[model samples]
Target: MDFTLSGQQRDRCASVLARTQTAFPAGPGDHQPTASASAYTRAEWSRLADLGLLGASVPTAEGGGGLGALDTALVFESAGRGCADTGILFAAAAHLFSCGMPILDFAPPDTRKRLLPRMCSGELIAGNAMTEPESGSDVARLTVTARRVADGFLLSGTKSFVSNGPVADVFVTYATTDPQAGHLGVTAFVVERGAPGLAVGQPLDKMGLLSCPAAAVTFDDCFVPDEQVLGAPGQGGAIFQHSMRWERSCLFAVYLGVQQRLLDRCVEHVRQRRQSGKRLAEFQSVSNRVVDMKLRLESGRLLLYRACDALDRDDPDASLWVSLSKLAVSEAAVASSLDAMQLFGGRGCLREEGIEAAVRDALPTTVFSGTSEIQRQLIARSIGL
Candidate 1:
């Protein structure tokens, strides 16, 4: 498979990078979250939509850019490189891959017709609600229940750590329909924000990615019509897995962009900064660290591109490739960020330098979108472990 991007793809990447630079020109200080500013404002979100980033992967008929997995990954990487606020990028990825993808792929035509345009236009924001307080990775153990009702279903449960929860207009959530069926009992539904008995709790304070507001969402016998159901009953597991494959394959490309930007800064710093009458770049130790950062970035990028290729081809080994990609990129991001901090010295420790914030942002990459450990487990299973 040719991993080389076509001329058109290169142009798209350049366009996205230019747009992100114009849309978010602020440095790390201006981008930092305040008590009153925890997430992207409506205007900023709209700006992103205008850039065609919010709908990069959705079908063109649905008012989206109709980008495939590889193209989508390239768009995200460009955004990461241009935008200093990783939190907003993270929020966008969750909204697109984790929430919008399932509805686009599995929801009824009517539902898709109604939601996709609004979602693509930035008129509505969506969230994924799968993780409960009790169930993180284990979908079968989710306590959320969806009981069949006369009209549809009545959902009751609490979802913890919902990205974009505080501002989401709708959510693609999962609930257990038959407790006896294990994972098969789980079902997916698109629940609106103002549905009766549906409540969004206060935003949760996070150590990083604060610009992406997360909160607990509770459904107290919330009613949902059959039309809102995504895929058939008992297909929630597969649907969720499908969305995650998209996420793991493409979402981490954002980190690649982040790493690239960080590496650029480190190279500039080492070349300009000096010690003992010689530039930092002249020191083998300092130069080696920068080399390692470059190594990780390029290597991780290949794995990411390969994963995206696997997804595009619908390869049976897609999961293995995705897990490998996610693990490599996430780990590389954290390691490169730390190295950047060290290279920056005392300045890096300061919030203003943005180096520390980079570390904080990179730290969570390994945890979200399934942990590094879970990816390893999937990889092990693929190898007959």
Candidate 2:
């Protein structure tokens, strides 16, 4: 019930936010032409690694800060507020929550021992590969196969729309070992990069989050040694769902930070810009819209932090909270971004102003980490409706 951040958490967020603002280099020229590919330059990526952000949620024993769920959310919220590139922010979230946590919790002990330290140190980048061309939201029906081999499993299939795909050094991905067994047939693996048969496709052009490159990954009889298997052979479904709980709860915190930043920008613009000797903020129409944005943000923050607490406590309604939190924050981001753009007028439409870019990044929130429709369905089921 007490969602106020601890003093230590506040300090951590401040430190992270200050550093994030200065990390990204300015665009090539004063007049930025268009959204570039969401590629992570080595320098920016290294700077992130140096900040210890890559390992914020990992345990200190594994070279991380060992922050709890609330602390981790706070840190990411800070990053979202100042980071110039949504792709980088998105990749960081995917790396920390979607890819890293699953491996830390479910991978074989030897695999964890081998990967966690490097991943935490930023020596390696990790990606979660679950979406397939044929099965976007249906995990049970994935066609990717992990066939038994002499000493391990031979993985063969394509994982599409893989965030961090172009640059990942390891993947916490899924495949089915027994198609006839339905969900019970699913198996997860820690597939390392450069495994002979594994190949990354060209980066896909996206509407937003241009700084983070996404690509398809094809596994052609890629051998995953026995030690690389995560959990049991038939438990990948549960493992994937467990990771999604973390992603849906905390990942949207990035959007929260972004929305807050946009709100501040709009407030500043309206107060200073005058119409017929009256400031825009003085107009009831503009002020009312701003208040609405604020209300959505405050309410959504409550839901998100509560969901993080629920996950920490392993509450019975943890799943429901996660779904609600994801839905609230994501929808709020898309709506708030639009308000920010409209308030800024023509400048908002310009690619160089960065307001429209936020809208583009916000658009995908409802689709990934489960759609808004899926969240509502889950909530309906929880109350026996």
Candidate 3:
């Protein structure tokens, strides 16, 4: 399979990087300020909208770029590289790929028509609330419940670790309509922010990606109209699975960009920073670590690109490939960040150099999307374990 990007794709990537670079926030000194109070500030939000990033994957008929999976990977990877502020990048991915894509794909006509246009215009922010307090990777076990009413459904329970939660205008949420049916019971819904009983908690002060605010969302007898149900009552598990395919396959590309950025900065640092009357790059240990970072970077790119290509091609192994790619890229991100920290030594630990931030950002790779442990189990099962 060929992995080279097309001319148009390269141009698209370059263009995206340019806009993202201009708008992303830069931390002054040691303290990193989030681009805004929430995951997105209006200024950067408009810039992304103006750049056509908000709708990169929407169909042209929907007033979007109408790009495919590979195009999404390309655009976002560039966005990740252009902005060292991975928080904004993460917020962008959660909105477009994780939350928006599913709504566009599975939501009813009225629901999509009401939300997607504004979402693409950056007038609306969406969050996917999948992980519950009790169940993270074990998505089938979430306890949130949805009961049908004359008007629609009354949803009750809490969703935890919701990325983009604090600032979301709408949520693509899941709740079980029938606890006995297991995965089949979970139903997906498009719950607007002002719905009667939906309340968003204060943004969690996370260890990394401070700009991308996360929070717990509570639905205490919240009413969702019938039109807002995505797909059907029993199909939420399927919808969530579909969204995960997009999230794991595309969102992790941000890490690919981060790893590349880390490598670039490290190379520049070692070449310029001196030790023992010689450049840091002259030392075998430092040089070898750089080599290892390169190795992980290329491997990650290959895995992600291959998974993307497989999805575009509709290959039978697409799911397996996506899981593998997510695993590889996420793990590589953590590994490469460590190497960057090691190479920078004292400065790596210092918040001012931005090296420590990368490490903190990369640390979450193992936990989100799918944990490294979950990925391994899924990969094994996919290959006939």
Candidate 4:
């Protein structure tokens, strides 16, 4: 399969990269001392929205660009190379995965008409509320409950580790309407911010991705109108599953750009730095490490491109390919980041230099959107092994 990007896609990627470099330069103060540090740059977010890059993957019918997953991934990869703020990319990926695709695929007409336009215009921010305190990877075991009410449904539950929870204008939340039905009992609802009895909890301190705010959300008899329900009752599991597949597959394209940056830095460093009267690249050990980094970087890109192709084709094996791509890209990114840090020696550890920050930021790739172990299990199931 020819993985070369089309000429138009290449131009789009170049444009985004140029804009991001000029508008969002990495700074010494970019490193956060606290885990709960607000990492999003409102101006940058607005700029991306204005460019219509925020809605690149949404359908054109909804006022979006209607770009495919591959195009979106390329844009994200470019952004990652240019910006140190991971929060912006995370927010975009979350919005596309949770709100853009699912709503386009399954939402009722009125709901779509009301939400998609604002989302396309970048006037609204959306999040996914899935992980409960008791249930992280186990979607079937979620304890949050929603009971049928006269007008809509009374939702009462707590969702933990919610991305963009504090600032989200809307949330795609999952709850159980009938615990006895297990996965079949779950349903999805669009919960607007500031709705009655809804509260955003304190933001959690995380080890990495400091810019992407994560918090717990509590719904205490919060009423969601029947019209707000996504898909239908008992379809939450399927929706969640599909959303996660997309998230895991395409979200790391941004990191691909980061890997490219690291590779360039490594190349420059080895060429310019001398060790024991010889350039760093002359040393067999240094050359081998650089080669390893290149291998990981190239292979990761291939996996992502393959996954994107599968998605575009609407292939039946798309889910398996996506899981594999997620596993490959995330783990490879972590390895590449670590290798880059090691190649830089003590300079990489210095906070102001940004290598340490890259390492820290890459740490979360393996844990979110379903952990690495979960990906392995899914892949295993696909092969019936």
Candidate lDDT (C-alpha), each: 0.91, 0.86, 0.85, 0.83
**Most lDDT-accurate candidate:** 1
Candidate 3 ranges beyond 4 A from true positions: 25-31, 34-39
Q: Which residue segments of model 4 deviate by more than 4 Å?
A: 28-37
State the lDDT of candidate 1 residue by residue for 110-205, as single tens digits.
Answer: 999999989999999999999999899788878999999987999998999899999999899999998999989999999999899999999998
Better of 3 and 4 by TM-score: 3
lDDT of 1 at 283: 96
Query: What TM-score number comes out for model 1?
Result: 0.98
Question: Which of the numbered candidates is closest to the native, going by highest TM-score?
Answer: 1
Off by over 4 Å in 1: 28-31, 34-36
Q: How well does each candidate superpose onto the true structure, as a TM-score?
A: 0.98, 0.96, 0.96, 0.95
- The sequence of per-residue lDDT tens digits that candidate 4 reaches over residues 123-171 is 8878889999899888998888999988789999899878877678888
Give me the displacement of residue 113 in model 4, in angstroms.
Answer: 1.8
| Candidate 4 clashing pairs, residues 3+ apart or interchain | 39-211
Which 10 consecutive positions of candidate 2 have the poorest summed lDDT?
Answer: 25-34
Q: Which residues of candidate 2, in runs, are more than 4 Å off?
A: 25-34
Q: Over the stretch 1-385, how does candidate 2's per-residue lDDT look in tens digits? A: 4656778888888998888877754352112224554377767777777766788878998778797777778888888887756668788889988888998898888889889988887788888899999998789999899999988999999999888899999998999999999989999998889898999999888887777778999999999999999999999999999999989987888888988888888899999999889999999999999998999998888989988888888898999989999999999999998998899898898777788888888999999999999899999998898
